[model samples]
Target: MSAATLVGSEAPLAQTHDVALVDLDGVAYQGHLPIDHAASSLGAARDGGMRLVFVTNNASREPEDVAAQLSGLDIPTSPDEVMTAAQACAALLATRLEPGAKVLVVGGKGLVTAVERAGFVVVRSADDAPDAVAQGFSPDLGWGDLAEAAYAVAGGAWHVASNRDLSLPTARGFAPGNGSLVAAVVSATGVEPDSAGKPSPTMYRMAVDRLDARRPLVIGDRLDTDLAGARSGGYPGLHVLTGVSSARDAVLAPPGLRPSYLGADLRALLEPHPAPQRADGGWWRCGDRAARVVGDGLEVDRQGPQGIDVVRAACAAAWAAADAGSGPAPQGVADLSA
Candidate 1:
């Protein structure tokens, strides 16, 4: 079984976990701009002996491109150290089809290269009579590409999507990701493609195997995909507040989406995680803070310089309440931004 709630670590996570399957888009950089403290904290963790794998759901670019971008952002990554959903998706299709199978590619160079590397014949349209349609995210994709995918799927071709993430983080904001494109095909043909990206354990398992990591931790910003993938992959995950999900989201997450630890940013890797403990009056306490779910609300003890401990305690109390058949009041969680 997965850990029931947030877990404490005696040492920094970089020391505790042998490898980190780190998410790229939201956790590391938001649309090319690196998150604050990400590069330095990651460097510190690497210096402390933890191996890092850049596991990403974005299938728009190749691993080399991803590595270059990360290196440019001061993350100092290599192609071999990066894994893309396009690669995983191609590998998945390879298992389902024979070598040199005709696959209609619907993304960019990343997906095309991945399919080709998997020993498949990459085609462009449904007219190719492709055996499979490999769909991923690409900004240049248009109605013509989606139409071809729909036609292929409508003609009994197997549909494979890199991921099902509904949103992609960008410098401006969240944009429609691969999932949105997949949904269009699904809506047109009423055929849901098999997804091989996050929320599925395949990507995480692949990273674990490739890195030969005995103790792997998942680090991400989204609770629905990244954290959910960690739980399904049987790895502990840290939910950071750098991207999509909020602290209140953590407090309200169900078991499948709940994270093992929570932090404000990448710096969490260098600090010890304080476990929340049960205190008097049914409150959950962490560090110098305490919180308990009241009737449709939460009574939080606002101690500590930063309210991380209080946030931790609040999450614990909320989770405890949820496990017992009810969740903490929305009003209490409404402003849990810290």
Candidate 2:
């Protein structure tokens, strides 16, 4: 996890996760689940509406793979809707590097392939590190290989890290990520590499430019990468609890690290003007909102606009419905509600 500095430490005047009403296709989307709603929002925006691009800092996977992963989570997304730091490196070098310039890699195939596809020739540097070590979740790394990379970086090879996340979570537990490996190189070489992940304007510029999107909104799970990245890019970020950062992080979050909006998942804003009403009957009344047993599936217009309360009630409903063995929430609420 990124240590908390003053929020907006990098960009003092940038808006943190301050959220507000935004319209798409003549309807209002609560904008809490930005990542979940990204694809549909972009599509709807274009058809006489608006657009958004999901700039993700997680660099282990390419754009297509990331989109596929999100899809499995029931997030409606497209390859064009996702941009990873791996892809950013490719886009960054595209304009700066000479065609097919020799480059050394320090991450995984995602980063390597991104560079190669960008027309750079990736060569193992004279520095002895295994070129690059793919470290994330369960990294198959050896001390000798890391020692080699340390030597190579000390020897003057340019080092590129796919991301700077300290750990990635899995079914098992937290594990070291590329950021830890890059630390070895930094320690040996006294050279800080240009991080290609979140909070790096280089990565955000790539995704924003790719979609030619203006006034775009960013969405993701981690406050360190996603919210900070949005701050760097002068955009708003929506934080969701399904992934990395948790409710505790939001409450204790330093200023810059807080999200503009928060949601249980992408489904929070699928409907417009969701209101929770308890009637005398066993059935309650919720209109212009999606429902499930998990959270109140119930909408409270009064949840504080900022921080995790931003969507706590929604989460409560979803969690409740889930315990009741509810099937997927009502479908056909217009795919854009995510």
Candidate 3:
């Protein structure tokens, strides 16, 4: 469905969609920490007959490790239920390269495992006369690693990157992700690597195919990656506020970047979503709140306790204004507090 025709679900989203292609880091857990209500909400969705697939751009860990980590967080998961960018990268490589082709790896064990599983021989240095180069993210990556990848790519080896996420969230803070390291190789060889992750429809399409899901909902925290990927793959996206994106971001989203649904957290999956309707005097009403685009700003009129409904109405008003060529809504236009 097109962004303009996007509407809220009258039924619980968990009952409407057969599968959920969920982003791991921000929507489920942040770094090693479990997000509030994530596990319980996910479990409830599972009980409601929705299959959950954890998707990640992090190529440092194997599926088993990722599943184990989720289990540790009290969210029971299996390797088959997880899809990594490394797997997507390897799957793409398999279609281009011949069987048993040697590929120079520049990341961690996860990348190596994915390549090997795809019937490609994993090599280390450029001296191996590699058929291609594959890169991903790893905590132990060093300057020496980027040099080898650059050398291989410069020597005519095809290059493929697991993902292009610029920054990764960690317990300490944001750190350089695979995309940052991939930039180094690009600078050295003046060549770009093919990516097989989010924002590129490949990973989402792969997950949908593997799950055999007729109806899938992509749930994520990042608009650029997860939600953008969902739009590219023709799937509805549910944006969560527990991670990087805020209500302000959603209200200001441009076409093709807007999510079909918005959630404060995973628990929104269990609740029916009310559609925002146009009211008199340029006002948009959603549930207990009404918002209007006044000049270049938004004004929210709450009829009940302040909640996500206010954000929904504000987004409707802002998007409507933008579509009418009224320009972007003013920043800090909505009273976000409860």
Candidate 4:
């Protein structure tokens, strides 16, 4: 659907969607710690009859380990409720390579287990004469691992990467993720690996199939990964502010990256969404908030009862202005919280 045609619903989102495909890093936990309200809100959503599935691009940890982490955080989950990019990458590789084909693993035990489960033999070095190379993220990975992947790819082994997320959030701060490591191999071999994570539609499709969801909502913090993947997979997405992207980033998002719903956090699933309607005098109204385009600039005419409403109105107005080519690109949202 076009961004201009998007509208909010009077019914609570929890009642509308059968399942929620939730991203892990930014939405549920920011590294090793769980985000505020994440556990409770998700539990409430589950109580309200909405199923929750944790979808992560991080391929370093196995599904069972990820489930254990979430369970320890008070959000009980099973391995079946979690989907990783490594699983998706392995599935993709299985379709191209013969059963029991030797595949060089360039990442962690997670990727190795995934490839092996898909009936491929996992090898460590290019000297193994592997038929393909699969890479993911692992803290234990080093220059030696990248060199092996590069050699394999340079020698014409089909290469696959779990995801291309350049940076990962950690308790200390941002650190290089799988994408940065993948770039090392790319620079050495001058060949790009086929990605099987977010923005590829492969992972989303797998999640949908696994959940058997008739109507699923994609929830995440990153626009480039989660929202982009939802859009590519023809699913509705909700962008939450509890993680990476801010209100300013959401308002300025391009057509493909814009989310269908914007919320402060997962609590939005229980609340009725206020539609932004075009108002008199070229204004847009959402709940008690209003915004307007004034000669290549955006002006906030009224702040809503809640800060999120104001953000919603501003996003609608800015996206409308962008579609009509009547205003400059939305720089930021005034009076909106991050």
Candidate 5:
């Protein structure tokens, strides 16, 4: 069935106001190459009087490095506006540890520096068991290092992980993330760590604190990390099918991973004075267009690009209808199993 038919009974809370837009990327730039759509969406977010932050789960790089990456992407972002799980892990440790606390940081210099910046004494594997081992993402982790991490955790140090992403997307493909390292420790020491990445309240708390956000909306490409995170934090999430998520995957999200709003890209929400259309047997207005569902899917003949923008219009209409308590027939979009 169509997306509208999926949202059968329960009405989705509608948001007609500005929303906080967060970009999940290590850097907006890669050497001389700029991240596609980074500049435009970020610029649009700023112009719309919306809060914008780059929330990256890549704990391999420090905030400064992330800033430099944005500089490369030609996306202008301040250091304060950048939030990394590496930084969040550090902050969590600092608040709970004593001054001069010994930390066994596994991962990269980013985690090390963040821990040190948080007033914790940094320790490596060569040193004695530290007070904690902050596991962050490291691409070149050695097998021996996994043993070392196990030893650190078994030695009675607190285990903290930057993120639990089993794999991270790269220019090549999916690679192991910091969660892989944390898994080693868990397997060896029988200990699970406190995570500071997506889907964790710790990461959300850090982001909300940094942005001073109130009634903020989570925007992410992944349902597990982004939508689950928002649900865990009791906030609404906007799922944009622009990154790793496929249309089929989105149609089959688990209950906890469902997004309040679904769209194809960032432009659907960031554009100023967009159009409205009739879609999914309903009407939606964004900027100047109306979207309605004509069949199993949305039908938008508006004067703009087809894709995520069109999907956004349809989603907006559905959301509006839901809020008005007169939206589509609820069929649990999560059951689509695309």
Candidate 6:
């Protein structure tokens, strides 16, 4: 189907877009647990002829493993429908390194296999004198693993991180993610790593090109990584309030981090997005709901349909204010999400 060039549309995204580049963790599931509406919502999007591509920053798991987990959660995903940061990292390394260059993989099986598949020789330690160091997250990684990565990177090896997500969501709470561990290596080596994950736009563009998506909507919960990547790649993004970011975050987002559309959850794919329009008196309106920024605070007036309209109006109003040299203060944004 030929997709329209429109970003925020009156028609359902399922009908307008050919592909949905979905973020897995907070959008589809929270760790090992399934989301309440995610399975059915994504299934409906698929049935409506939108191809689903599950994009993840987690370099620990393989596509097949992630697919199996989503399938078990009733999402009915295939390995081909999944894209991981591990694969993206490998691709990034391939562009810089020779065909058989040695990469000291300081990650789990997924990252190691991805580097090997990209025609790089995978090594274990700095003692191997590898050409590069690929760092990612693994639950079993001990002090030895960090030391090895630090040693290799300090020895003039190119350091590459799969994703710079500072925290990982688990069933219990947030823990150290790949970025946290990468920081340890950075502390020792005094070197920064080139990432091939979200916020880079490399992974997003790679997924779009691989999937051959003409109109791909980058959907995620984070404003920094997902929406920022979409902005850089010239793709429209739909931000859902399902994970780390909240409705208030969208309102105060800078130009690069702002999403094209806002949704409460995955089911937003099935609905129309009515963008907030500029109204009189420095306000933005979406379906009768209105919002505006007053000094450092934000005001929401004229209530409308519950969930999404408020976010839309708030974002438009706040964005306008910020662009004009006035943004919202933290004290005022707390109630939008609540």
Q: Which candidate leads the pack in lDDT?
A: 1
Clashing pairs in 3: none
Give the Å error, residue 85, model 4.
Answer: 0.5
For model 3, what is the alpha-carbon lDDT of residue 100?
Answer: 95
User: For residues 65-154, could you state the per-residue lDDT of candidate 5 as single tens digits?
Assistant: 777767566677777777888888888787678979898877887888888888888887835758888888776778877777788888
Q: How well does each candidate superpose onto the true structure, as a TM-score?
A: 0.98, 0.61, 0.95, 0.95, 0.74, 0.96
Name the lDDT of candidate 2: 0.50
Q: What's each prediction's clash count?
A: 0, 26, 0, 0, 30, 0
The full ranking of all candidates by lDDT, starting with the best, is 1, 3, 4, 6, 5, 2
Alpha carbon lDDT of residue 163, candidate 4?
96
The sequence of per-residue lDDT tens digits that candidate 3 reaches over residues 1-338 is 65642478889999999999999988889999999999999999999899999989888799999999999998999999999999998998988998899999888898899999999999989999999999999989999998999989999999999999999877777788899999999999999889988887787888899989999999999888888888888899998898777888788887777888888999999999888999999998988798888887778895678788888888898999899899555564754642
Question: Cα-based RMSD of the predictions, in order?
Answer: 1.1, 12.6, 1.7, 1.7, 6.9, 2.6
Whole-model lDDT, model 6: 0.86
Judge candidate 4 against the unseen true structure and give its global Cα lDDT, from 0 to 1.
Answer: 0.86
Off by over 4 Å in 1: 304-306
Candidate 1 residue lDDT tens string, 1-338:
35658999989899999999999977889897878999999999999899999999988899999999999999999999988899899889978899989999999999899999999999998999999999999999999999999999999999999999998888888899889889999999999889989988788898899988999999999998899999988899999998999888888888889999899899999999999999889999998888898877877886546467778998899999988987676666766756
How many clashes in candidate 4?
0
Better of 2 and 6 by TM-score: 6
Question: Ten-residue segment with the worst summed lDDT in candidate 3?
Answer: 329-338
How far residue 139's Cα lies from its native spot in candidate 6, in Å, is 1.0
Q: Itemize residue pairs with steric clashes in candidate 1.
A: none
